[model samples]
Target chain A: MKSNLELLTIETIAEGFRNEDFKPSEVMEAFLENIKVKSELNAYIDTYEDDAVSKAAEFDKLFKEGREDLPILSGIPISLKDIFLVKDKICTCGSKMLSNYVSNYDSTVKKRLDDQGVIILGKTNMDEFAMGSSTETSYFGPTLNPWDHERVPGGSSGGSAASVAGRLAVASIGTDTGGSIRQPASFCGIVGLKPTYGRVSRYGMVAFSSSLDQAGPLTHNVRDSAILLDTLSGFDNRDTTSLKLAPTKCYEALKKNDFSPSEFKIGIPYDLLREGLDSEIDQSFNLLVAQLEKMGFKIIDVSLPSSKYAVAIYYIIAPSEASSNLSRYDGIRYGFNEESTPETLEEFYVKNRSAGFGEEVKRRIMLGTYALSSGYYDAYYLKAIKVKRMMQKDFNEAFKKVDCILTPTSPELPFKLGEKKDNPLSMYLSDILTIPANLAELPSISIPFSISSSNLPIGLQLTSNKLCEDTLLKVSSILEREVGFKSKT
Target chain B: MVEKKEVLKISKLSRLLIEENKIDSFLKNFSEIIEYINLLDQADTTEIGKDEEIVEYSFRDDSEIEKLEVEDVVKNSAKVENNFFAVTKVIDEE
Candidate 1:
């Protein structure tokens, strides 16, 4: 009596496709129908119906022709965060500024996804230019938390994480700048990884905060994230910041499991857990630690002395970088244009931007410009970078004694959608536990820990040193098994 | 509290127009955020040196990048003329 496609993981669906249990087109139809009925969730800004069907049909034909060596992601439908370019597709980056704009070239990430035969279901919504923590700043409207239908899904990757958690897409890719990906993943009770900063290329991915932005996957499980990471990561000459390290076999690395819990040391930063955290989350974290200790991991007290200043440093540095990165949106090139003819060039710039951008985007841009202004550059911007280095040094020192660090992914659970929208400071504080990873350029993952009394999902975050995703994934996968939290469709 | 004039100055510098009615409320929130981030002033960064390894220079063969088509380039513009984007006249006609 099950007319709908089964809620399956990306790995399960790929195996099903290989075995011909269900065609890709059939799965795509079911997902598209689900998205239509659940439109109230606001998880997707657009879904490619005709294109997805045709692409699925092409994959089915290839599979039928006995192409046993098909790419791992072939026919797997996924969603993009709207920041990455997909040639000829509208990439709004969740802003009115680029509402009608189409990309002429595919971003490096899109090209890699295409090469592996991954079909993009559509471009998902996000915070306008990836700015806000709740996705409330998106010009299209906020993406609701699927779990409660009234709470936020967390952002600027809210739509990306929500799409996967709601079973609208098998997996989704989102960019993280100061916990955009990990925080939303935690809120939605899905697996979200922000790979080390340069682990993925940024070419043609709409720039937010250049130094901190790294695109990663959102999935229901760590294995799917590892699968997507293996496909999405590599060196691309187009992005100068792209790392030169050899691509990892993350999926295979998950199987190694060479280390035991007895040999592992987990770091708990007392300063991060001191205050401003929900008691429910603190309880969940304590339970997780107890479970780990039962499995034999020795918990060590670690100090990230500079972490208390991370939020203050992040607000200054990210916005300062954003202000510079966003200057390319002048109407004379591409994106929203002023309707009235301006008499002066300055008037043209002001009119187009003022009309195109939302309130938060403009606010950040102004704040950034002030911070980087001539007189205050040394006091605000430069000082922030110095503190950023100290934050990184703290992590480098902590890793010496601990295999990985554990913290609450967010200070609180998924909150009501409009609760903190009006208070920008409160929205910014939501990322407190997750921002240190971005500041330190380390790989971090958020996995479900337990369920709240209010029936919402709670998450625990794990962090490892630079380029140490294998350790993070290994630890998270073990935790995922012990927790065994089920995701509701 | 920040002066009203300073808000206007930053807005102009950012090339964003703040509506007259919204400026008062906007400045209030802006001041609060500014005050919050000012907590960094308490951190003693005296021992931290300037970020020397910040930039990593990677050079490639000097070559022209493939340019986007004129049609695609001008598609989102409000006005275009003869394969060029139309913009406000920069020079004055005396």
Candidate 2:
């Protein structure tokens, strides 16, 4: 088995497959070998060794027959965050609740990826229900950051990000509710994109906060992300919210769009830069801005005054939505249930839920329930909705003036495992800058910036208007090139 | 300040049982989180008057589609009987 296939990106792997440099099964084995060697990273929940290998063989045979219908991602090995259901496979959303549960049908994401002829390695671990900032809350365990074993890979999409960064898989897909994909992508020294809401269908992707949840790409570079997003995005009747727009435009634009850096005006919301940002991150971000300016890109200061309340708005709205969505996990229908007898329906539900969920998930559920409860609903849930409108208004105003907005993907570098485990507020606050974009339903991507003095990677974030992933990927790829930052090899 | 009893109440509503030992810490964390999010109170939404809720529904013809088999629907249940979910008794035996 060749060793370099695991490190080859989706784009490079596609080129290799086109050139018949190596068989797809060889690529699958290389990734499988890497997964076995890096098992301690705990990136993968399970590896479909036989299934993935067989699928790669089928693709290889198709290649031999001179098939003209092969997509750009044909034979590329990738991983999915466990939340996206793969039919006939277990879809454990990083929670004990669905540990034994098998998916009955393919999530739209899985169906789309399957159509692309991509070889799926397996499902990756995540924060339980994609709830935590780090993968620590996963029932399987925290996915250790490959850059530094002691540190965390920022999560609920930590495993997806880590798989790409650690080269355990060629590229992966992760969901970003509130920085789940981007933050992990930043921490793992890779590119992660959270596309505009409704850009991709959510059917089969488990709901956390229904409105805030959208799936996108986690990859080694911006082009790969565009390619994956192109494959994953489209309208589906199964997902009513999925946009009825032309699909597969992102990768084409990435290949053909020629808007020079000088034509782009990137905004920096200096006001939203909280006081406690790590000084090193501040220096690196400033350097990045200077580099963009040097490249003839116009950098402007835009104000998003309401973004300061983003954390507060996200906590209330996400949890309130979560409380309702999660109610489907009643013990009678599906998910984990007690083996022992409970006399009443209420007792059965409480017994299963209390035992099924991890700490952070329960906390969010309770917080959501408290907010949406009778008297408090107006003060908490309604109030947050009003504030969310303000946040969205701010983004609307900003986007009118600038093509895109720039911010630090994370306030700090990847922290040590167990660092913020007990501090839920701090963990929630970690998402401050990222939440505003989610609130506005805009497209955002995190690109690797530079390594800190401690050798951990940091990422710079770019946000574009809703449904503007084309420009988002354009700006990101430009920055990805300008910086020329390489991940730890 | 959020009280312990309020936390318990929220847990009851959420269908989650907080253990006796974990309630103290759970309550502590819950209170702190609530306090932190209270920052939203500072944002003046006075001008943001009652935004009338508007929901736009996209209409499509209601046509028959393939549906999950009964066994497929109930396969993930902890207990399935008669091709349906089996649950604890909902009625009392007087």
For each candidate in turn, give its C-alpha RMSD to the true structure in angstroms: 1.4, 1.3
The runs of at least 3 residues in candidate 1 whose Cα sits more than 4 Å from the true structure, single-residue gaps closed, are A1-6, B64-67
All DockQ scores? 0.75, 0.77
Q: TM-scores of the models, in the given order?
A: 0.98, 0.98
Candidate 1 scores an fnat of 0.74
Collision pairs in model 1: none
- How big is the positional error of residue A463 in model 2, measured in Å on the Cα after superposition? 0.3
lDDT of 1 at A90: 89
Q: Write model 1 residue lDDT over A140-196, tens digit each, in one string.
A: 999999898889999999999889888899999999998899899988999999999
Per-residue lDDT over B1-94 for candidate 2, one digit per residue giving the tens place of the 0 to 100 score: 8998888888888999998998888888899989988999999988675665454434456886658888888888878889877777888889
lDDT of each: 0.89, 0.89
Interface RMSD, model 2, angstroms: 1.3
